[model samples]
Target: MSLGSSKELAENKIILLYMIDKVNMPVSNHHITKLVLENKFMNYFILQQFLNELCDSGFLELSENGGKSFYSITPNGKKTLEYFVNLIPFGIKSIIDNTIPEIRSDIKKESLISADYTPKSENEYIVSCKLKEDNFTLIDLCITVGTKSDARTICENWKNNPQQIYSEIIASLTRKRDKTNRDKDKDED
Candidate 1:
C-alpha cells in the first residue's frame, strides 16, 4: 500500500510499537532492523530517526543489556499505538503476525544460553558464557583455556547444559561448605 511521508513514518512507528507489544519478550534492535529492512518500512536513516524519536518521546523503552539493544513499548506507547495500529496496512499486520513466532523462538533460544570466545594470544583464548532470563543473566562466566579447540568445546558444552553445570557447581560448593562446618563442629565438641 502507498502512503504519504508523514503517514508512512507514523504507521511504521506504530508497527514497531505493535510488534513490541505483541511479543512476550523485548525485541532486539537487530530483529527490528531486520523487519524494517525485509518489509521496506523506510530507509535506514529514517528508521533510525523514528527509533530515536520514539525513545525520546517515551513511546519506546530502549535498554542495553548483554551488549545488545532491546526495545519494548512503554505504556504510553501501547496506548498511543492502539489508536494507530489499525492505520497500518492489513498486509503489513498479517506479515508481522506471521513473522513473530520465528522471531520469538530464535530470541528465546539465544537468550537462554550463549557462548563466545575471544583470542587472547596465539595459543590462548577466553570463553564467555551466559545464562539469561528476562534481560537478566543468571550466570555470566569467563574461562581462559589453552587452545581454540578447548575454548570451542567449553562454549559448546556451556550452550548445551548451562543449567546443569550451574546446578552442579552450586551444589558442590554448598556440600563442601556444609562438610567443612560439620568437621569444625566435631572438632570443637
Candidate 2:
C-alpha cells in the first residue's frame, strides 16, 4: 500500500481502539462495523481485518459474549492509543467523542439484560438468559424448548422483563424462609 493508505490504516486502527477504549465495554463486532461505516471511517472489510490484527497483535482482546464476538482494548492498545492519538484527525476524534456516549448506553443496556439460543439437536434449542447489575450477576437461566420459535420467545421475554423476572424469583424464594425467620425472631424477642 502507498503512504497515504498506510497512514489511513494506522489511523483507522487507532479509531477502532479509541472507540473501544472510550466505551470500555465488550463492544460487539456489529457495533464496530456500524460505527466505522456510519462515520465514513473505513470499509467493513478493513474493519474486520483490523479487529483480527489488533487482537492478534495484543492491541485488543477478544472474547465470546452473548454468543457474539466482543472486543476490548488491551493495556498495550491503551498505551498505543495514548501515544499516537494525535495522529487521528480532529474530525474523527470529535465524532468519536460525540458517538461514544450512545454506544456506552447501548452496551450498558445490553449488559443489563441479555439472551441467546443454542441448538441442542434437530428439534431442541436452549435459550440462556442473563440479568446483571454492574459487576454482579443477578440471574443466569437456561430453558430448553422443543422448537426454535419457543426458544426465541423465551429469549424475548427474558430480554423484555429480566428485572421483573428476577424480582419474582427472589420473592418466591424468600417468602416462606423470611416468614419462618420472622416468626422465630418474634418469639425470641
Q: Give the top-scoring candidate (lDDT).
A: 2
* Pairs of colliding residues, candidate 2: none
Report the poorest 10 consecutive residues by lDDT, candidate 2. Answer: 1-10
The alpha-carbon RMSD values of the candidates against the true structure, listed in the order shown, are 7.2, 7.1
Candidate 1: stretches off by over 4 Å? 1-4, 120-122, 130-143, 147-189
Candidate 1 lDDT at 62 equals: 89
RMSD of 1: 7.2
Q: Give the TM-score of candidate 2.
A: 0.72
RMSD of 2: 7.1
TM-scores of the candidates are: 0.70, 0.72
| Candidate models: Cα lDDT each | 0.85, 0.87
Q: Write the per-residue lDDT of candidate 2 for residues 63-105, one digit (tens) a residue.
A: 9974678898999999999998998899998999899899888
